[model samples]
Target: MHSTPWSSAHRLDPADQHLRDFLAPRHSPAGDGVELDVDTLLSQKYNGVVELRVQVAAFSFQNSPSSQNAPRLLLDSSTPLNGVLEALSGDATYAGCGRCSAELSTDANGIYSPCYPCLPLTGVRRYYRPGVLTVSGRGYSQLCVLAPPVPLQKILKAPPDKLHRSSAPGSQVKLIQVAAERLHALLSLPKKTFVITIRSHFLCDENSAPLSQDFTLLDLQLPTDCK
Candidate 1:
């Protein structure tokens, strides 16, 4: 059996057969060589909180810092929608090709038509169409996704008045600080495993009317020590 970052060698409980089956690898039409399996360590729900931990097999960034010393702000793409298009289309060239022309094929004479396939048609080309011989449009701009963690200590130290405020720009900032503090405190703990407690509440409508607020922890940033 192949070992994944998240997989363990220990056997699972027979009583958890359903969970085992769910974790089993599933075939992909992409091909056996490309078969994909969930790289998850665990997923469970208790009360109103749902928790999940998974390993990333692979990932790509549309825009990355040009150099280690590059300004963090400059690393962001000027146009984010275009960045997404570039990622999905395998960069500007492929995206341009897709937008500007149709697929090329051989003529009865065996002469390649619509220009010979771009030299070194490998890698992403094997899975997707390549860009046109010439530029198609202005092309895609860079973009990125950022999720910074907060420390738990900051939250605990936040002013009482700010915490009580229901809505305000400063209040939002205070909340973020508090969350960071909490996260920092958790990471500082000596335990290898930790459980985070999240509270859920109802959201108000435009008129400030209460709406069902089933809070879900979508993301968490672990401290470098834990990593």
Candidate 2:
């Protein structure tokens, strides 16, 4: 027998199994729905309209979005997440207002060794910020990495110009969908590595507190290195 790159020697772990189920391909033999095969993609020379099965997310709202039941969602691994972020129900992504201890900087090597910074903090609201992520070790480093970031936004407003080019791992990043029941787990983050991103207009009641933490949902994800 021959072993290929996808041979049984490598398979998704239980934690990763859901990711495969979350992002569906354009074409599948399982359903009668339209499918886009390699032949079609090649026929267009890789440029044309394409369809994808989205992971529609809806929150069971009862009170405030800032409460433990905040609005949030996770997409594929974190690789091409930004490109498809808007496609996930056309929701808006809010920026973080949290302040790092001090001014931070990055290097051409794509490693952040000085002070840390926060994520995409771009929203109409003020005085409020997104969640906080800290790494612990004998000595650690923090870099606000953007997956193929929003181009100019990711570079200009980003940690640095080289940031948008930093994420060089495989195209798969573990996305965490914090279920209300397991919200507490967010505190530990198990491995202590993840991305706490958000979506806009994730309202649960008639009233909206754009500045309130309620508008933010917890994104308890694994770092971009999970099989």
Candidate 3:
């Protein structure tokens, strides 16, 4: 397993039989591979108090960042509506990407501060089609999908803003923050698979080949018919 800056962070649900079956072998396929993803569903509210539930998966990706994009993890949610809107409106935070480096604020006792500083993704763009969400960043590119909520045929789509070069190694991904009022509706949408494409600035190995590829597909089982 790759080492991360954090010594102890939350691991994926071990109870997930399917994820265990897939990750049992710590090997990255030179090309492609797929496993029956069986992991617990994640639901949490953000600062806007928007509720988000997404399936979580851990996979050995080719171009994934080494320690720079620490926390060494990625997340996917069936939140095209939530995701795109957040992106356009600029309300999402990039989690598990870079470590925060902020000054510590201490109490009267002079105890170290609890809050940590974090780095956010810079120079990224996100757009929504009826069915798909497209993201482009300095060295990263991504596509997000929310299913059944709206049939692909009924959905009109548009391209994401073009990304300009950045000092980072991969194209940056967009983080969407949602409104509290929209949280319940986001959670209420019919469950579907959420797919995210990660393009890392790092190469697969020593070859210097790009490390951007599709990671795991998380299935969020939402209830209700997508209009």
For TM-score, the strongest prediction is: 3
Per-model TM against the reference: 0.17, 0.17, 0.19
TM-score of 1: 0.17
lDDT of each: 0.29, 0.28, 0.29
Model 1 lowest lDDT segment of ten: 129-138
Q: What is the lDDT of residue 141 in candidate 2?
A: 23
Candidate 2 deviant stretches above 4 angstroms: 1-71, 74-79, 87-129, 134-227
Candidate 2 weakest lDDT stretch, 10 residues: 52-61
Clashes of 1: 13
Tens digit per residue, CA lDDT, model 3, 1-227: 99879678677898899888997866433222222111211111011111123322211111212234534222224444544353334312211212232223346996544443332332222322212223222223222333221222122111223222232457354222222113324333342333222221222446635444222222233234322
* Candidate 1 error regions (>4 Å): 1-173, 192-227
Query: Mind giving the per-residue lDDT tens digits that candidate 2 earns over 98-170?
Result: 3432222336985444322344532221111122222222223221212221321211232322222333356
The superposed Cα distance between candidate 3 and the true structure at residue 160, in angstroms, equals: 3.5
